[model samples]
Each structure stands twice: as C-alpha cells, then as structure tokens.
Target chain A: MAKRFSAEKYVAGILAGDRVMLSRAITLVESKLHSDHELAQEVISQVLPHAGNSVRIGITGVPGVGKSTFIEAFGIYLIQQQQKKLAVLAIDPTSQRSGGSILGDKTRMDTLATNPQAFIRPSPAGKSLGGVTRSTRESIILCEAAGFDTIFVETVGVGQSETAVHAMVDFFLLLMLAGAGDELQGIKRGIMEMADAIAITKADGSNKDKAKVARAEYQNALHLYPRAASGWLPHVSTCSALQQQTGLNTIWQTISEYLQLTRSNGYFEQKRRDQNLQWMYEAIRQGLEEHFYNHQQVKAQLPDVAAQVKEGKKSAFAAASELLGLV
Target chain B: MAKRFSAEKYVAGILAGDRVMLSRAITLVESKLHSDHELAQEVISQVLPHAGNSVRIGITGVPGVGKSTFIEAFGIYLIQQQQKKLAVLAIDPTSQRSGGSILGDKTRMDTLATNPQAFIRPSPAGKSLGGVTRSTRESIILCEAAGFDTIFVETVGVGQSETAVHAMVDFFLLLMLAGAGDELQGIKRGIMEMADAIAITKADGSNKDKAKVARAEYQNALHLYPRAASGWLPHVSTCSALQQQTGLNTIWQTISEYLQLTRSNGYFEQKRRDQNLQWMYEAIRQGLEEHFYNHQQVKAQLPDVAAQVKEGKKSAFAAASELLGLV
Candidate 1:
C-alpha cells in the first residue's frame, strides 16, 4: 500500500524545494523495509531535470578522524556566507556481524543539525561501496532538486581501495592527522595518487607543528603525482574545526580556481560523463552479484557443493560449473 | 583432448613422492590454456588424501616492505635444517593490469632459488582476494603431496583487505617496518587485529632502534586484542631479512608452540574446520557474483534502471525489483 504513493507528487515537492518530502523520498529509497525501489525510480525521473547544479564532494578518513566535526564546521561556513544551500550525507561502514553502525555522525554534529540552511543525513553503509551508501547518488539528486548547491558525501576511511567514492565525486578530499611519519608510508602512493586535495585535520594546539611538517611532506608528494585531468595541481593544507576557522577560504578559493579552469576547458563536462559511465558499471556489477546469490536453484544446491569443496573432495572450478549447470 | 589426462597415473607418481610429475600435474592445474578445468580436478582428487601434512604459513606486507627478501631468508633456513622440502608462492596483486607477472622472485631471492629442496612459484592474483592466484590453495595441497612439509603463501601487502591469505594458512604473519610514528596510526586496525604475529622487518642498522620502539608499541596494542583460539598471545618481534639469521628461528618456534598447544586441545582441528567453512562461504559469494554479472537478462536491463536512478527518474530499489521481476 505504501508503494502506491505517487512518485511524481514526491518528485514535484522535491523540485519545488520541499525538504520534508525530499527526506521521506530518500528514506523510502534507502530502506530495505520492502522493495519500494521501483516506485522510487518514478519519483527520481520527475526530479532529474532539477539536478546537476550542485558540486558533489566526497570526504573519507578512518573512524574518530573528526569527519563529522569537519563537515559540521564546513557546512556552517558555506551557510554563513549564503554562498549555497548545503547538505551533508555521511555513510557509516557498519560491522557485518552486528549490522549496526560504529558511529552516527549526525549525533556528533549537533550544530549542523540545528541549522536550517544545512541538511545532514547519516546512513548505514549497507552492502555497497565503502564510502557511499546504496542511495547516496540518488540522495544527491534529491538534494539538488531541493536547491542544495553543494553536497558533501562523507565516508569512513577504508584505507586503500576507495575507487567507488572517487568515481562519484567532483572533488575527492582526503583528511589526515599530523605527525603521521613519512606521510608516504602511512597512506600508500596509490591513495595519495588519487586525492584532489589533502587536508590535515586537528591542526590546533600541539598538533600544529606536526601539521606543518605533514603539509610540507604532502606538498612534496603532490608534486610527484601526475596532473589531474582537470589540469589543476592537487593541494594540501591544514584545518582546525574547533576554532571554526582553518583556512577554509583557501580551500574554497582553490576549489573555485579548479572548477573555473576545468569548466572553461570542458573538462568538467567530460568528468561528469565519465562518472556516469563508472556508476553504470558499478550498478551492473552490484546488480548481478545480488541476482546470483538470490537465485533459487543455486541457493538450494550451494550448501551441499560448499560442503564437498570445503572438505577438499571437490575443486572450486568444478563446483562452480556444477552450481551454474555448466557441467 | 587435454581433459583426458590420467588421474591414476598422476596419483601413482605423486604418492611415490616424485616431485617432477607432481610439478607437472600442478602446471596442468594452473594452466588456463586448456578450456577444461575438469581434468585438473580429477588429478587433484586422487592426490587429496596425501595432502594436509604441510604447515601452511601466510606472510604479507606492503610492496617494498621486503616480503620477497624475508621469504628468501626464511625458506633457506628451513632447507638448511634438512627440511629440504620448502615451497614458496608469491601472489602478485598487480596482475590484472599487467597480463602476467615477469616472475621476478629469482632476481629478488637469488639464494633461495638455487636451493634444490626449495620450489618457488610466483602467481598472478587475477580477480582473487589477497591478489592470490585461484589455484594457490590447490597448489599448496599439491606441494604437500610432493612431500614439502612447509608451504608459504606470500602476498604484496597492498592494504587492509588482503585477509584472504589468512583464511587458508595455519599461521598468519604480518610484516611491518619501525618508526612508523604513533605506530598505532601506521597499522590499520582491520589487518592488525587479524594478524597472529606482528614482525617488524628491516630491523638492522639504524632501523633497529625504531624497530624496538615499534615492537613495544605493538606489544601494548596486542594486549587489547583477544587471545587466539589456542589461548596464545599474538607475538611481536623484529627481523632483518638481509641479515639472513635475524628472526627466522623465532617465527618457526612461535608456529611450533601454537600448533602444539592447539593440537593437544583439539583447537587446531576445529580451526581447520572453521577455515573450510570460510572457504565455502567465499566460493559461494564469488560464484553468485559471477552468475549475477553474467546473466544476460539482468545485464540488459540494469543500465536503463541505473540511468533512471542517476537522473532521479527512479529509485534504485524500486528499479531493481522491477528488473529482477519482484514487482
């Protein structure tokens, strides 16, 4: 019965900048309460015409890396300047055993929660990529429909292997702490090679000196990375969320300069096209994974074949072919 | 046809402890050249009863972390003790981009390759976890059939996700370098928590002091982790692979003690059983993933739904159900 709601009505509300409706639409989409996914797609179709104006930023770091604090401070800065309507979407990577998230970022970012100009949503990172939630890219569309010009997609740092988030965001910012010896060793060259910007968080008080040293190291490393397709050199800087001022102006200025250069050269459009292709590929891969695991015939035979394979009585290839009836 | 290889003949040669025929059989199994995986499995089944006598050890660390150097020194130590049968397998994670490896371990471990008692195989990771070749587990079984009592699975420590090697090995060792500041920050909690032993590599010369300090830091961190199922504490030590004699004895001693304690208490048998179960689970997951992605109908419709979701024209969940025929 709930699935019968008009998708067009919700999408119209979203396009008209109704926040409550947008929130409800995203909830319906993210929920596994039932497969209301198809109906939600109809609503999305009505809302697509209004998206694409927002700058999508992806933020990631390990737990307790002050991701929430950073987002709250950054969100407030954008709202205060009345530069753009801002939204913060944090995807928490949960423990597989407990199926519960380690942190609920909204609870930690109280100031941002109360600000009308800022919309903050915390999502459990289900079975999707490490950085973005299942409905994140969709949620971004809704936010854009509701007139949000900047969207922050924050993820619990997954160490290396974060290509998923990189594929979806316009700017990928890596947050780190100072005194992390030989910056190159702490985070591998592969990860550093992907960052558009690296910000040393907790740059206040005793960590200030360490932050300065880290900044210098990162600056040197950035020089080693090939120039981004956007034709802008990756930048590194320090920021202190506690003081509510940590060279955010410099960050904004740098980003603006990057966007200006890329947009003028048509690189921004090409990037969006590339992102669309990437998302399509991930969607197909994920969709197939869901199908194969959920098939009735395969599910029934899995346990028996698994037992044989586990006991070393059968090989994996033979077992796999049998499971799919290719034998 | 290549699928008509004689399993009886291969089994006869293997039980007689003929390493030449055993190596040939393994080569047939690892070959993707023949479109038949069935013939290889048949040969493997005949040899299965003679397997499981080897102590499977997994060693991993980041690239440039001296993994090959350590394996060379360790493998040589086993051979000198007249344990002449030592097998080394290094799984390359970069194989997907580069069609096949150059198999360069000989250059890296010149001494060990010259030892008659030792056999080393460098395998491409392909799409497998830990960048391990698909046949690695099977290869270990074949190595045991050839009378090799100690098998080492070495993988490039790309990130925290290389836990696949741990699932198949009797003992899991993580290699680290010293002076990795805040020592805690340098080690990812995911990988560190799973390690059974933490060995600080490159511990000679100026690096020795840093190694000692890192050992102390890791010792404190190890205390926080629960004891192993065998009631053994995770060990922290230092090693210099280039020194050849630095820490190989400690590693062997630790594994021996673990096996002794667990064997008497029946924990070792149970642990092996659990590993079998884990392997089955991984197989099922991988099989299902392949099925879903390879399904013709599912592939054809997924992109349209994805595009709709991207444009905010459809909710991902709703679109998925419709494509899956649930709606």
Candidate 2:
C-alpha cells in the first residue's frame, strides 16, 4: 500500500497537474472511512478552483448496450485527433455486505484502461444518482486540474434514475440496441426527454438496416419532445463499436455545434451555472438529511410513531407534526 | 363539481365497505388542487382507525412482462377461491403532456374491471415512483377501510426508483421477462435484494421452456441474497397471464406462506408497526423541506451561494453552514 499523503499535499498535486497524485486524491475522497472523508473534503476545497474547465458528458444505456466498447473507441478517436486529454469515471454504487466495492470498470474498458493519454478511474464506493460516486464532482475538478479537457461519466442504465447523471453533465447521451423490443416502446419518454443525443449501438453489418430504421424512429420521437435549449436538434445516429468505426468524431462535432448554438443563445452557460447551484444545494440537503436521520433519538422513536400512525390511533399529519416538534 | 362531503361521511362510507367511495376519497387526496388536498387529508384522518386490515401486495415487472394481463387473471383467481373483495391500485405514474396514457391498465384489465367482486382503479397522476401513487399509502388505508381483504399495487418493472412502492407494501413480487436481457444484468441488485418473491412473466406457449430456465436461474441467483424477514425462501416461479394460469394463485400462496411464517415469528406485525412510524417521520421531513425551500429568499439565494462554492470562492461546508444558520 502506498503511504497516504496528507490532504494539503494531495491538493497541491492536483493543482500542479500530477496525474498520479490526482488519482490518489480521488481514491482518498472516495474512501468511506470517516478520517478519509474529512481529508477528501479538504482536498476538494483546495482543488475546486481548477474545475469547470472540462466538458462533462454522461453516457447511459441498458445492459449489453456496448457502453464500455463505445467509450474505448470514442476515447481513441479523440486522442488520435489530438482533441484533448480525457478522463473516464465509472461509479458502481451498490455495496457488498462488508461495504467494500466491486470495481468492475477496468475489466469492461480493456482498451481505454491501457491508453496513456487517458485517466480512467473506477469508483464503487460513493452513493449518488445514476450510481455516480460521491466524489465524482470533486474528481472532475481534479481531472480538470490535471489538464483533462473532457470528462465522461458512464452509468449503468438499468434504472430510470439516469436523470441524476443527466443533471451533472454538459451533454447527455443515451445508447440503445437496434430493433430491441417494440421500436417505439424500446425508448421511454423519460430517457428520451433528457437525452441531448441518442445513439443506436451495435450497428454492425448485420444490424445496419435495423439501426437505420431505429434512428429514423428515434428522430421522429425526438420531435415529440420539446426542443432542448441547445438550439441544435438532438441527432439520432448509429455506430459500430466492435469495428472501431470511429463515428464518435461526428458525435463530438454535433456536441460542439450544439454547445455553440446554446451558448450563443445564452442557454449553455446559463444551464451550467444553474446546475452548479443545484449540485451544491443537493449536497448540503443530503448531508443534513443524513445527520437528521442518524440521530439516535430519532431512530429509536421512528418505529413507535410508525406503528401508531399505521394503526389509525394517530393521524399522519399530527404524528409528523409532533415528531418534528411542530406542535 | 360534486359537493364535498364531510370527512366523517367519507370515513363512514369507507368502513361500510364501499369501493366507489374508497376510490373517490383516494382521488380527492391525490389531487394537487389546494381544496382537494385539504378535504383528502381530512378524510384520511377520519378513516385512520379502520386501516391495517388488508394484505398489501406489490407487483412489478418489465414492459411487455404481461403485468396487466397477469394481474387481471390473478385477481379473478383470488375472487373465485377466497370470494374476497379485492381492490387493485394499479399505478401508472407517468402520463404524456398530451393527456393520454399509452400503456393504460384499465384497457388491458378489461375482464377484471367488470368483475363484481373486484375493483380496479387505474393510473393516478403524480410525479414519483411508478409502483406507487403519490397517495398510494393513503389509498391503501382507504382500501382497508372499505372492507377489502386484499389490496394489490401493480407496477411495471422500471427501476430502483420504484423502491418507494416496496417500502409501503407487505409483499413485493418482481415479474421478469423470460429473455429480455442477461438475467444477471437486467434486474438491478438493489431491486433483487428487496424482492420477497420473483416470478418470470410471459411463461405461456412458446416461452414456457425458456421461462422455466429463467426461473431456475433466478432461483439459483436468489440464493446468494440474504433472507428477507418473512423467513420464506425467496420463491421463483413462472406464469402466463393470457392462459389464466395458476400463476397468480401461486403468487398469493407464496405471500400467504410468508405472512404465516413471519406473523408466527412476530416479524410481520413488528415490521408493519415500524413502517407506521417511518411514514409519519418521512411525511414530516418532506413537509418541512418543502416548506423551507418554498421560501422565496432561500430559493433565490441558493443559486448565488452555489456559484460561489463551485468557483471555490466559498467552501460548500461553509456556505451550507451560513445558509442554514448553523454558523
């Protein structure tokens, strides 16, 4: 085990753009140990100034949607084009019985993990919407500090909770299987409503025709949705990740165009500014909730109050009022 | 508009076992209009004493999992054998802005809706978990008051966000498609961990053999999870909603077995008792948060503080402390 550096040193490393130190700092922040949490916040406080320089993109899809493969191919394309250094943060929020993580991102992203120009961090410890790690926002800051101009937040899209990830990122991409389920039913309104762009994955030789049809259907569906503030229409496209076809450049080009359109119209900067506020407020709210519920007295009284209300001996309103000392 | 009845009259109708009044009161409560909300809460208060009488079951499955078809068939089975007055609060949480519900249950449960002994209410409006109406908890009380012996909450298997429905019900049954995706990756861990029983839906005709294999796989996978308090081994079974198969009966049997085992061991009553208190506390907490955040000053100031924290001009901890008057 590496001798853990102090918070100040870790913060200094991140600001100094040391990739190795930035990785270590993210790990420290993601640790559940109480002492590590305190230090994590300290490191975050010091590195916060260097954030907001990277474009945070959130990618989500159902299982077997080729998310890992797509990111790998996409990351390679960006590097080849010398666009900018990239960082990938994959968060698995579920914990085992012992509170340990089963960090599985590295195994999934075989190609991306080996890229020297990319910084890939897999965190399974944090709890946030979309399985995003608690330290992800801070980690993005560190990545930006370390000169990564683009950050990709990849989420396991089994749940309808993708909105959580959508809120944090600059652009939201949803991947889908070609001709999976009823073409209309395959895509949900909630997911479609949030998507800035939709991509039909696994569009190889055999699936190309189906992918094209799916793309057309998605395009029609996108029209039903209120136009996103990006002013640029949400594009529905197809890509074959296995073939390394590298259609990601076009995707990035679309994103750049969307950003330009939205920013010129005062939506892009406004949305980012709005999101940062939401992020901070939610963080504070969650912290306070954790404290309130964890209080021993509250926990002890909870069961009894629940029973009374359930039995009709007490009204939910009165019970709530009394419990909160409003009466 | 119908003249609003006194809360006492609503409670009286509930205790007298009138399903129409039971549903009407629930509708009144779930309405967002201020007057309806006030009357609804009053009605709830009056009927509080008559609740806690029925078996509450939660059913959830993926799209095309034949959830509506199965619920209809199973509901008929329960009425035939037990001759029990059964009520279903089938929740469709999302509705398109065009005011149409594409996947409506009332349309699918055609036969069950007309059954004299069965009362099926479809799609209450609210933004929240799919399995639950915003007022589903309150509706359960109304159903219990209305002399229903079994109340089923039917929800499509969406994702983890639907866990709110699980928190309120007595038994949770997860309905899965036979070949939707890799079974291991399709249903999230959090959902599988919380389920009381797993049932593979669409197990009729061509899918029968595959459903069997899926059930067996689920049974094997379920073994890895910790036992629920019911002391019932999480049962994995298959059913075809179209075949009017004994699937629903088997589901009921499993639930009964769970209730018997847990009730005998004092777990069932204890858990219900605990739930009552949890509801009261959660209500109060949400109420307070809503009220506090509703303050115009607080809402306006939040964005400014957020920007400061994001830019590193102010620390989140410090900003939160000052905002909440903790400093």
Who wins the TM-score comparison?
1
DockQ score of the complex predicted as candidate 1: 0.17
Lowest lDDT sum, 10 consecutive residues, model 2 chain B, at B95-104
Residues A1-327, candidate 2: write the lDDT tens digits: 445888789977887778789888877866656666667767777776767787889887766777888888888888778567889876554443233233335776677778777888876544444224446766776788778898988766655446667777889988888874433233333566677898888888889899988898878756654455667678888888765555676687877887788778987777776666666676667655656666777677767876677666886766775566522
Best by DockQ: 2
**Separate DockQ for every predicted complex:** 0.17, 0.17
The alpha-carbon lDDT assigned to residue B289 of candidate 1 equals 56
Fraction of native A-B contacts kept, per candidate: 0.20, 0.35
CA lDDT, every model vs. true structure? 0.71, 0.71
lDDT of 1 by residue, A1-327 (tens): 444457877877788888888888887667655457566667766677777898988887766567778887888888886467898876665443222245444667788789888887766556545224557777887898899999988765654335566676788888787765434334433455567888888888998898889899878756754466778889898888766554676677767777888889988777876676555555544565565657888788888887886676666556765766621
